[model samples]
Target chain A: MSESLIPAETLERVGEVLSGPVTTVIDRREAQRYAYAVGDENPIYFDEVAAQAAGYRTLVAPPTYVTHAVVQPRTAADLRTDGLYREGTRIRLLVDRVMFGGEEWDFLEPVCVGDEITATVRLAAVDQKEGRKGPFVRQVRETTFVNQFGDEVARSRMIGIAR
Target chain B: MSTDTDTAAAAPDLATLEAGQELPPMHKFPDEAQLFLYSAASHNPHRIHYDREYARFEGHDDIIVHGPLQGAWLTQFVTDWAGPAARLLGVTWQNRASGLPGEELVFSGTVTSVDAETGVVELEIAEHTSDGRLLMPATARVRLPTT
Candidate 1:
């Protein structure tokens, strides 16, 4: 087995809320753009009557969109060398490369246009494990989305694999 | 007023829906334009998704499709088939391999379980290339409208 990829400080970050609670209103135009970009023109996203017919209060955002809905804007000066924006806080890690592992989402309530949504990201877990290639680190970032009514609308867990 | 899909079709009847049933497959043909639009819509500035040369520098075959885009497709696969009335409860997907541009990606699924009492249905789903390369393995749960 190789050396530990997760340091003591990093492992201790488990269950800590890493990013601040970002609140944003679900915008109709932005949500529609996302739906159109995905090529999913589900009428419930475009037609109000159709959304109500489907038991939603109004036009609905696509499933899993709540995570994207709350992304706070960043300035161009914050661009990283890789073209991705620099995050406010960086998680320390000892790894050569990190890869996107997977994502899990739970939609508890309908996320509709014009709804105010607040999201907070937590470092759910971090651990080093033995893989076929030797040793790697598995980290999970869990984000919870709550609506204006104080109802938890959705939750997402994004897994990152580093070696 | 863009052309809409048959997403407005009737929701599945929980009474008749059973385990072992197969969902009709959905196909996607993503191009550079689609990728650009998605990047803009999602506010992602990841160069691997846009700069082909940079992507190759990063050791990718080509400007590969975004993992989250494929994930969105997985949700679309279930929701489009289950119809607009079906409430998507949860979805999970693993990123296995990269999907390149112009590849015909197919999404297929089988009903893993069904709860008649609560109108809940579970599915085992996947996305594959036309040449049979597995890109993502996924699962989802949805609540259908009762009869």
Candidate 2:
């Protein structure tokens, strides 16, 4: 994790794009699937006809539907060998022994099916501190979602806790 | 009911709930079906969310719930308590543990502070197991109708 933690003086270097811009296309089927998963039956998310009647040009996604756009079809082996963890530790940051600290999302536009959205994720901030538990790393990641038209759709700030 | 109304009406418009005051509990038991739908929805294909075998390989006991799902449940719970017209000014949550299927997750909220003139309610909300294992803890500010 120390490798990913840029020095306080070099924090500006972290903003440089470190990887490819992954493009995720949100379709109507996926939108409805996410809506049903949360048990939210809002017609704007489920029925295309209803959504159109409600003034949406096409079926739009729920407010929090962007969580599904970043997962790529990859194996744990790939993540493990590829150094998924900044250093090389098998700490289940997103699953076990970790926590979803908080999130802040700003929606600038709506997402519909066939909209090829690209997420440009960059490491925003990383800090370490000593607490009652032990030493831990708090990483803040920022991802901006833009559609094929190059219009910014949404931006998310994700806080991850790794111990 | 008359006494209850009188007390509510006389409570200085913004009654601050004490620490022990009961904030009605909301029950949510997310089944595998719901999990699948959520996995499909979020586009998060982390095997731990759906594949029991993959989850086991990754050291999880079962398909774990999504962090956002827990947060959304809490948001919905608070919204329901605050009523439909109450606009959500802001919400923040910290996930301390993972919730699995069949666990009796309860959503509860309490008024931590209030602004009488502004008619805003500061809430200390939480989602936890029936056994009191906290899953998601959050704070929210909502504007309530003064009337």
Candidate 1 chain B: 10-residue stretch with minimal lDDT: B1-10
Full-model lDDT for every candidate: 0.88, 0.65
Q: After superposition on all CA atoms, how large is the RMSD of candidate 2?
A: 7.6
| Candidate 1 lDDT by residue in tens digits, B1-147 | 122232344567787788998887788989999999989999889999999999999999999998988999999888888887789999999999999988889888999999998889999999999899999999999988775
TM-score of each: 0.95, 0.66
Among all windows of 10 consecutive residues in model 1 chain A, the one with the lowest summed lDDT is A1-10
Q: What residue pairs are clashing in model 2?
A: A34-B41, A68-B42, A68-B43
- Write candidate 2's Cα lDDT for A29-104 as tens digits: 7667666677655566666787676555677676557546555665545543212323222222321244457776
Off by over 4 Å in 2: A1-13, A18-20, A23-25, A48-58, A70-102, A107-116, A147-153, B1-25, B51-61, B78-90, B110-123, B140-147
Off by over 4 Å in 1: A1-3, B1-10
Q: What lDDT would candidate 1 get against the real structure?
A: 0.88
**What is candidate 2's lDDT per residue for B1-147, written digit by digit as tens?**
000111212222335533335456667878787777776666555567777877767777788887888766765565556553344455677777888876777777777777666777777888888799988888776666665
